[model samples]
Target: MTRIASCQCGQLSLTVEGEPALVSACNCTRCQKRSGSAFALSSRWNSNQVRDRSGKGLTYSRKGASGGNVLFEFCPVCGSTVSTSLELLPDVIGIPVGCFADPAFPAPKVAAWCESKLEWVRFPDGLLLLRDQTQPMDTR
Candidate 1:
């Protein structure tokens, strides 16, 4: 299946092919600050699975909680973060799950930085929660 995700102003768009290999909710400080929410949800796919990327966007690179570089691409016009690329995971792209605006989309199966998760934030039962990035991810 092919899914299209776009920025709020439609200045930037991404076409993702097939299902994502992983979907995660990150509660790290950077994620909270960047998303202005309790956590940020992302769906990860190999770079080859993404195509038809259109429009111009600005890139912001910052040190991730794991001390790796995480590059974010956002629509300059609307300032909406569209996608991200992590240095720790080469050749992989992470798209904001909310960008798809599909309520039927699968929920995140993994939770990262749970130590920083807000007290009121409740994850679904059976989710694989990691205190930090050091813990192994359950991609299966």
Candidate 2:
């Protein structure tokens, strides 16, 4: 199966094949700010999975809680996040799940940085929850 994730303005997009390697949620402060939400849901895919990218994206780089730089790509027109690259995982591209705008999109398998999670935040049962970023999400 193929999926397409695009920005609000439709200016930038990513077309990928098959399923994602992993889907996760992060409650870190940076994620909260970047996503403008309680947490950020992201799907990790191999760079090769991205078959097409439409339009140019504005790039922003910031140091993550993990101490590695995270590069964000957003639509220049609508300012919606399109995708991200982590220095810690060079070959993996992280796309915000919301960009897909699919209610059927897979749920996050793991929740990280729970120490920074809000009091009312909760995830489904069987979902791995990490108190901090100490553990890697792809351990399986």
Q: After superposing candidate 2, which stretches have Cα over 4 Å from the reference?
A: 136-140
lDDT at 1 for candidate 1? 92
Clashing pairs in 1: none
Per-candidate TM-scores read 0.94, 0.94
Q: Write the per-residue lDDT of candidate 1 for residues 40-127, one digit (tens) a residue.
A: 9999989999978999999999988788899999999999999999898999999999999899898888999988889899888888
Error of 1 at 23 (Å): 0.6
Candidate 1 Cα deviation (angstroms), residue 60:
0.6
lDDT of 2 by residue, 35-97 (tens): 999999999999999999989999999998888999999998999999999999999999999
For candidate 1, the TM-score is 0.94
Tell me the whole-model lDDT of each prediction, alpha carbons only: 0.91, 0.92
Q: Over the full model, what C-alpha lDDT does candidate 2 score relative to the true structure? A: 0.92
